[model samples]
Target: MTTAAHPLVVRARQLATGLLGPHAERVDQEGVPASHVKALKGSGLLGVNAPTEYGGAAAPPAVARDTAEILAGACCSTWFVLTQHYTPVKLLASTELPVRERLLGPLARGELLSGIAYAHVRAFPRVPVRATPERGGWRFDGTVPWYTGWTLNDVMLLAGVSEAGEVVFAFTEAREQPGLRPTAPMRLAALSAAHTVSLELNGLWLPRDSIVLRTPQTKFAQVDRPRNTNASPAVFGVAYAALDLLEAAPEAKETAGSLRSRLDEARREAYALWDHPVPHERIEERLAWKLRAHDLLRTTTTAALVAGGGRSMALGSRAQRLAREAMFLLVQGQTAEVRQAHLGHLSEIP
Candidate 1:
């Protein structure tokens, strides 16, 4: 069945299809192709989620999902980079007007590409590569182990632990800063065009005015609040895309059917929650959505490989890259136990 096509989805499909010959391999290797980036910027497609005030298409979360799914079908690396920029733009939109004017405008216009340096090993909390203060600014230090689109980004949303043990998000220009250093890009099994690398920030000082938002105590609570509905559609879209890939494989009939049925169930549950008046209940619902989405994609992709008699692992195949990219969803947040607990709650939801 043809998915209901939005205008953005149509345009994205056209762009993805047109660029496939030239960009498909590059995106698989580089994570995101330069040509793809240029095209997306020139076409103003990157701003689909940016607010109208910032000269963006200001499309809904569903548009973002559709766009991502379309792009992923052609180039997973580009979709990865696009999602990185899109999420930060959504976060920026929630900030004060001055911050929006200063950062969001250029970002929405596609003149700027961005990355995030947020992850750190849990054992070394003090070793987090970036940190900001409670009241105003931040003093960033440490390094992010895996920073995607580092070379292509004009800016980055650097996150670090604060003095008070809170998490802070700081926006910084990539080129101007001497302290923020990018290492050579790493070779990955897939999503090569993403330009993933390590980042080092030593004694980087950002003033209070540069601070976008901070979450005290639990960082997840502040940034990924229960009410943040912007990410659900994107998660759904990625799962749908992976499922679409599986469905196209003759060996994947049974697997695809099972995955699609599960996804439809989860989608219905999520949409029902969305339509309800429960304000903070969405946090759990989003977690559930991500968990189920990840499971469906992982299971379907793995099943497709087995059913395809190993031909799916050939170079330049969509299934090959998707198999590698599927691993990303497993490492996202919380732990196995936490995910299980969340799953229990989700399972219990009538």
Candidate 2:
């Protein structure tokens, strides 16, 4: 339902080609500068799917997926930092709360960039973080093992399990203050430029009004379980980027073409399943398509490196950078169910 020329999608294209692609190699080494984020904010691609009432594009899923693919292909680090903004937008759109009126407009208008910290809740039994009810608010403790765009984020949607078996997600300024402190950025295989960090929350407290979603664990899992079943559109973006590198080498064009044909089919299946209204339906098919996308991403990236031969070993080689980025994408947003499915598939022998 989204057109290629959707203003937001076109903006994403312009950002990717004009800024992200050219400086990606340097950014990969020097870290994503604030200037790159400034460009994203200027593009308004940050609110590609936010409600139009807030001056967002309110574009369709097609536009969202298209822009994701284009931005990720150019620079996954910048794409990742911006990607965190959409989840908060989606969550706010569904809930009628004081926070919605307070935050949605700026977030949707790209005036504020938010980061996500709730994925840790996916590790349910462990409850890595906890929120204990206090007088006017809740006290958050324990550690958030993974938070991307740490210092670059203006706000973060932090989550912790409560004594009543509810997951409490609240928003707060993203910085070291009170009981919230962030460790140094992690050294990672890829997208290190996104500035990943771990947060130690000793007694961080937010007023009850700052709370967004406080749903029972069961309901949260039901919705969260299927989110990663289908391969993310970013997977296709990185996969095709590798394919582009491979195709550039005349000797590898035939192989790249064959892989591209297969990737196309897998993308179709994965995206079709993503568009299904029922989130819990056809999960097996969704996981299968996810696995297929991961497989193609690995194969395509590896093929690119092989085609580049020794030149791929250079730090500046696009082939090398794409390969490492592909590695990170394969595991990013991985869930226990998805992990089991992927490991189970890999364990099978010919």
Residue-by-residue lDDT tens digits, candidate 2, 245-269? 8888999989999999999999998
Candidate 2 local accuracy as lDDT?
0.90
Q: What is the TM-score of candidate 2?
A: 0.98
| Overall lDDT per candidate, in order of appearance | 0.67, 0.90
The reply for model 2, stretches above 4 Å from the true place, is none
Model 1 regions more than 4 Å off = 1-5, 20-22, 119-127, 130-137, 219-222, 225-255, 271-279, 282-289, 333-350
Error of 2 at 206 (Å): 0.3
- Sliding window of 10 residues with minimal summed lDDT for model 2: 1-10
